[model samples]
Each structure stands twice: as C-alpha cells, then as structure tokens.
Target: MFHTDCPAREVVDHVTSRWGVWVLISLRSNDLRFYELRESIRGISEKMLAQTLRALVQDGLVWRQVEPTTPPQVTYGLTEFGREVGESLAELFDRITQRLSPRDAG
Candidate 1:
C-alpha cells in the first residue's frame, strides 16, 4: 500500500493528519457548529479548521449542513462511514493515552 498512487494512502493521510484525527474524534460524539468545533479542538487556527473540514467533507467522511437563517448556520458531523472510522480512532486514542500515562508506564 506504499505505492505513490495508492488511494488508501490518501485516505490514511486525511484520517491520520495532525488535525484530522482530532477533528474526527471531536465530531464522533456530536455534531458541532464551526466555532464550536474550533473551540473544542484547542490551538487549531480558524484557517486550519476550515481546511480540515473541507477535506473531510470531500472525502465523504463528514457531512456539512447549512441551515437556512439570517446568517446561515452551518454544522459539521461525521457521516456513517466517518462514524465507523472515528469509533476506531477513538478506541486507538484511548489505548494510547492509557499506555502513556505515568501509572501505566511505571
């Protein structure tokens, strides 16, 4: 799967990117508005968040909904496929955290 043009590689890159993983994990539990998502993922700049969301949406891993209103309320959430991927990522993240804790490391 290491071939330069492998499609899985692109998917993996998107899912495992520095911000992508965090985004997926954050959206796994609930859909969030742009600002809500940005706030939840601390330290992520507005630009980065937008870019990440765009990629996820294009990949069919996320759904972007625009509510009709004066200001156009926009929300982001994981697709069914995204939920599955996010679930696995969440489990992996938890395991990593557990293993790295001082109590576990000792």
Candidate 2:
C-alpha cells in the first residue's frame, strides 16, 4: 500500500463510481449472489455488474464467498469498511430525497 496523507480520491472512485455506489448500497441490505445482485440492481447489464464486482473485490471492500452446491454459488457482501461507506451514502440519499420531496407542480 502506497503511503498517502489522504486517499480521498481513491475513496471517491470506489464509492461514487457508477456501479460502486449501488453495489455497496445493495450489499447493505444483505449478501447477494452474482446474478442476484444483477437482478436486485435494475437497469444494469450483466457485463457492467460483473465489472463493478471485480473492482470492488480488488479493493477489498466487498467480500466474495463461494458455496459449493450442485452448480456452485457466489455471494457478495460489504466488508466492515464498506459498511461505513454504505451508511454514509445512505444518509446522503435520505437527505437528497428529503430535500426534493415537494415542489414539482405548476
């Protein structure tokens, strides 16, 4: 790990990336398999979903567990560090929604 005074930019890339934010939020609800995550996150293509997961996995923010079943299953969930990011993002979402709740009428 390269030493840095602050890694805010790297954190932003992991948290605010198109799929990164969503994937983190989705995992906050519960652990989900690869396809399950894809389905839970609507409007996202499989390729993008796979790509995002790979990035998160590499960052050590998302944990991937494989279950040996007949066909095998893989689940993704947030690591402890990821949970903090998820909570922060969730609060931001709530604030945005509260602020935009009304005033769309003529």
Candidate 3:
C-alpha cells in the first residue's frame, strides 16, 4: 500500500507514526539497548516497541547490532540516512511539543 506510487508518503508515514516518531527521536542521541529504549519511551508496550523497531530496521532507518555474549547483547542506532531523518524528526517533535504546551497554548 505504501510503495504503490508515492514514495514520499511512505517515508512520511514511517517517520511520523506514533511510536515511529518517538523511536527515531530517542535514537537521535545515542545507541540504546532494547530495554533501554523501552524504558526511555514511556507507555509503549513491548509488542509495539518490537514492531516499531522491526519496521524501522526494514526501512533502513535503524540498525540492530547483536554482540557475541552470554545472553547476546542487542543495541539499536540510526543509520547515516536515519540520522539525517532523525534530526529533522527531532526538530519537528520539539516544535510540536513546545507549541502544544499549556503556556504556549494560552
């Protein structure tokens, strides 16, 4: 459905989905482990977070690295392309949040 014709719409949908926006903005600063991301993003269910990460990975916007270890450490970070997109999303997130604040609304 997304890839039918408008590639821009597909990218916008991926970047702006509820959890997708938060995920991209969260990863803008540093690489984070699965639990770290879960903790950082309040109110996100485990299933939803997993699904969001999977979609971002499929979109080439996030990188999933699995290290060799006893339990196997997994971390996520943005790709170069993702970083560029993430920065834009971050700015948008900030602007929206600020504009919607009580003081700003008043």
Candidate 4:
C-alpha cells in the first residue's frame, strides 16, 4: 500500500484529498445540483468545488448527469462504490469529530 508505483495510491489520494471526502459525504444522501452542492459544503469556493467534482467524476466515485433544460442543469450523486466509500468515510468523520468535541477536549 505504501509503494509509490501502486495504482491504489492515486485512488487513495483522490478519496482522501482536502475536499474529496467532503464531496463524497455530501452527495451520499441525495443527488444535488452544482449550486446546491456548493451551498451544502460551506466555505468552498466555486473553482475548488469544480475541481473537486471533476476529480471525483473521473475517478468514478461520483456520477454527473446533465438534464436537458433551459439552463442545462447538472446534478451529481454517488455511485454504488462511492456510496460504500462515503459510508465508511462518514463513520470515520463522526468518530474524529466526536473525539474532538469540546467535552472531550480536557
């Protein structure tokens, strides 16, 4: 797993990137349009969000669907594999946040 040449390294990097995990977790529950996703994840800039979504889509962790409409709406959601990954990441996130809560910080 630690080998530099390992293919999983790229996937791991994408999955655990600064915004990757958050993106995955955000789309886990429901499909969301670009603006909705940006709103859901506070403090993320438009450029950063676009880059993150593009990476996730390329990795097959997120599915992007474009609707034929006046403005051509685009939505993002997690794939089956992505859902599994998101579930695991969500659990990890919960544990970390719980441990770092004010009550636990003596």
The window of 10 residues in a row where model 4 has the poorest summed lDDT is: 97-106
lDDT of 2: 0.84
Error of 3 at 32 (Å): 0.3
> What is the lDDT for 22 in model 1?
95
Instruction: Answer with 1 or 4, whichever has the higher TM-score.
Output: 1
Error of 1 at 104 (Å): 10
Q: Mind giving the per-residue lDDT tens digits that candidate 1 earns over 7-36?
A: 888888999998999999999999999999
lDDT of 2 at 102: 75
User: Best-fitting candidate, measured by lDDT?
Assistant: 1
Evaluate residue 42 in candidate 4 and report its C-alpha lDDT on the 0 to 100 scale. 90
lDDT, candidate 2, 1-106, per-residue tens:
3456557666667678888888998899899998989988888999998888887888778899989897889999999988988899888877777777477321
Per-residue CA lDDT of model 4 for 1-106, tens digit only, reads: 8999998888889999988999999998899999999999998999999999998888889999999999999999999989999999999988898889688754
Positional deviation of 16 in candidate 2, in angstroms? 0.9
Q: Whose TM-score is greatest here?
A: 1
Candidate 2 positional error at 60, Å:
1.4
Error of 3 at 37 (Å): 0.4
Give per-residue lDDT, candidate 2, residue 35: 90
Q: For every model shown, what is its TM-score relative to the native structure?
A: 0.91, 0.82, 0.84, 0.89
**TM-score preference between candidates 1 and 3, better one:** 1
- Model 4 misplaced regions, further than 4 Å: 102-106
Model 1, residue 84: C-alpha shift (Å) = 1.0
